[model samples]
Target: MSDNSGFFERVYEVCRKIPEGKVTSYGAIAKYLGAARSARMVGWAMNSSHNLEDVPAHRVVNRNGVLTGKHHFGGTNAMQQLLEEEGVQVKKLQILDFEKHFWDPMKELPQEI
Candidate 1:
């Protein structure tokens, strides 16, 4: 009912579509949701998504491919560990070959119905 909850659902919907071994930026998700300036809100949604196993919160990183949300995943390296498990390279808290791994929701998803 609340606007944030609705937005969080939208965020999760996009997250579910993020394929393994790939990642997206918070800003990208916000842009795809028609809220270009709501990247921080997208980060908030990722932080709140731990309980939802299907959300793939680890696949959402900052624009520069930094693991900015790592702290929220319990361990300091939890986020990095998860991404690494999926074969995404993380070094010094940043994703290597970032662009190669980046998934743009606006491009990956079909036109909105």
Candidate 2:
């Protein structure tokens, strides 16, 4: 595994902790991991999360709560569908009531360092 493999594992751990019906941003996960500018790396980890059954990548989105990675979830609507099933509303590829559903790992998880 590359050094990023550890980063990806950490990302997966954060993603797994996202409660059902809530969501978080790639940037939030990156910042939680101590790399504020590694939002794209968070996205990259998410792209690999599909192989893990419990990663819950559907609970992750862009800062605006847009379903930017929806296409990776098997179809254009798959990610949105999963969110909707969990009680989150999506309209025009954007999460409705985003603030209400937002789950920040930094706020929710206990500090490890």
Candidate 3:
């Protein structure tokens, strides 16, 4: 495995833990991983997450809760569809009531030693 595999694995693990009805920001995941400036890396990991069925890449988004990764999901609406199916509201590619649906890995998961 590549060096980034571990980081990507950590990303996927946190992503898998995201509750079905909630969503999180790439920055949030990055910060949780102790790489607050690596939000783009988190997005890159998500880009490759299609190979992992258990990784809910669609549950991740930009800081604004915008479905920025929607294009990677297949069709333009695929991401939105997935989020809607999970009871998350979307409008103009942005999640409605995002704060209510937001999930923070740092807050929900145990800290690493």
Candidate 4:
């Protein structure tokens, strides 16, 4: 496996912790994993996670809560569709009431980062 594969698994682990109806950002996950500058790595992880069954990759968005990764989900709106199914509203590819639905792993997870 490539070095990225390990980090990708770590990203997926953090993703699995995101609750239903809640959303987090690539930056948030990276920061939580103690790699604050690795937000793009988290995005890469999400892009490669489509085939996984329980990662809930839809729950992740850009820091501003935009569905920037929507294109990776097979359909133009599949990411938004999944979020909507989880009770999150999206508008113009951005999540509505973003802060209200935001899930910060740094805050939600029990361990210190």
Residues 1-113 of candidate 2: C-alpha lDDT, one tens digit per residue: 68899989989988989999999999999999899999999999999988899899999999999999988988768899899999999999999999999998888999732
- 3 or 4: which has the higher lDDT? 3
Off by over 4 Å in 2: none
Tens-place lDDT per residue, model 3, 9-84, is 9999899899999999999999998999999999999999998888999999999999999989886698999999
User: Candidate 4: misplaced stretches above 4 Å?
Assistant: none
Report the Cα lDDT for candidate 1. Answer: 0.93
Candidate no. 3 TM-score: 0.96
Candidate 4 Cα lDDT to native: 0.91
Please give, for residues 8-106, the per-residue lDDT of candidate 4 as tens digits: 998998899899999999999999888999999999999999899989999999999999899898867888988999999999999999989999998
The order by descending lDDT is 3, 1, 2, 4
Task: State the lDDT at 5 in candidate 1.
Answer: 97
Worst 10 residues of 2 by lDDT: 104-113
Residue-level error in angstroms, candidate 3, position 27? 0.4
Better structure of 1 and 4 per TM-score: 1
